[model samples]
Target: MAAIIKPWEGTFPPFRMYGNLYFVGTQPASVHIVDTGEGLCMLDTGYQHSLYIVLDNMYRMGLNPHDVKLILLTHGHIDHFGAARALRELTGAKIALGAADREYATGELDLSYAKELDMTYTETFDPDILLSDGDEITLGNTTFTAIATPGHTPGAMSYVFPVTDGEKTFVAGLHGGMGINTMCREFLDAYGLSYDCRDKFQAAMDRLKEIHVDIFLGNHMQHNDTAGKYKAIGAGNQYACVVPGEWIEYAEWAKQNMLQMVERENQR
Candidate 1:
């Protein structure tokens, strides 16, 4: 197992990303705040210790935590869902996640890999909304369609929504999980996952290619060059808004990377 390290300890200033979307996470986890016009919707929470960073960023952007009506998780990974319980308690927001990931979050299944890596997993609470593929999540003016992309985990989900640049509305996509770090035998044994992760990942990529994604976001910033894109946006670069086909290219690249990993493991 790789040594666990705190990679996202630093704070990042919150900024609006086009329309009603805001980035309010640290360097490691990518937490997105979406304004639905009725209430706020948070995408993913960082680790338990990173909760304060999220809250502080929200406040910095003139967003009240209490106004958050929904907390949507990408997966059940500790880094992704760690602050969910606390945020829900603090804001009374309804929490939602993929049904399969809910089992891992609610302790119905073991997540010993997290313990091995010295990550924290404190309390577990039931999700108010259990999501499935193709399910529509409507919150005021914002609506998102869930796409099951089970590679990072059995219940990993991607979301497709709309974002406007004050004039033209474009379809935006947020890939739920991108890492195949849990594909190793040791990690799978610890978590008791038996699915063919590589195959599922490829299938998910194939499905994603069919969707037109003008704006692509990832669960983690690094996955989508988030920091760089944000910098471009801040600098008023015309290409800051990515080209429409970038999502398909990214998916293809990710799928190929996973295939290479599988090949390397087979050689061993």
Candidate 2:
């Protein structure tokens, strides 16, 4: 199973989160492509093995390689940023990421702090530019901000943007942490990242209160399941998410749910 998922899985038009943002799932990761009007941008290219699939999806989305100006990454996980080098070669787009995660992406940093994942430094490339907290990226009338949130890894970041035009402010939760996945659940049980899951929960909760987030979404897979709103990522079926703002409510709940999961992991 590689990244070429059935086109039907995404349905037509893809959920237009906004006029500028969009997503497509590949085998190893979900590709977030953006059109800022200055040109195209992407977040988190898929695994090394699925490079072509990512490129193909870009074409499917009507984006040419040359249109891509920047590839902003969530964090340095291999699957998330592995295709960066290839995409860069094709598009000549500069890559942006948290300055702290630079080494982790290029394979200079091992990221031993993370529990079950054995991230090794294999090859390294410098980020053309470094992203810092509160920096706003403007594309004509639209703007997105970078928020620094550390837990999954130091220098982990989530992109926050307004829900839509005319909206005063609403941050889209991207890459703060995994809501849940096969690897994540298994890793939690196996590595036991924290003894105090409650602390982790509270920290995220506190952060949420400080921001004006009305919607929540996950890349790669589904993290929120309510009614027919979502299909869990691992499900081998076509699906899409709805009532997205409900996701933030789930994040509020995930804070507690994850704490419990951690508690169980610690006990295990």
Per TM-score, the best of the predicted structures is: 1
The models' CA-based lDDT, in order, is 0.81, 0.59
lDDT string, candidate 2, 227-266, tens digits: 1232332253323332445555655775666667667766
Q: Specify the poorest-scoring 10-residue window by lDDT in model 1.
A: 1-10
What alpha-carbon RMSD in Å does predicted model 2 have with respect to the real structure? 6.1
- Return the TM-score for candidate 2, rounded to 2 decimals: 0.72
lDDT top scorer: 1
For residue 39, model 2's alpha carbon misses the true position, in angstroms, by 0.6
Q: What lDDT tens digits, residue by residue, belong to model 1 across residues 1-268?
A: 1212543446777887777788898876789988888999899887777788888899998999899999888898887888899988898999989987887888777661367556656667788999999999899888989999988888888998887656778787888787878876666766577758868888999999999988888777777777888888789874465567878988988888888887887899
Clashing residue pair totals per candidate (backbone < 3 A): 0, 2
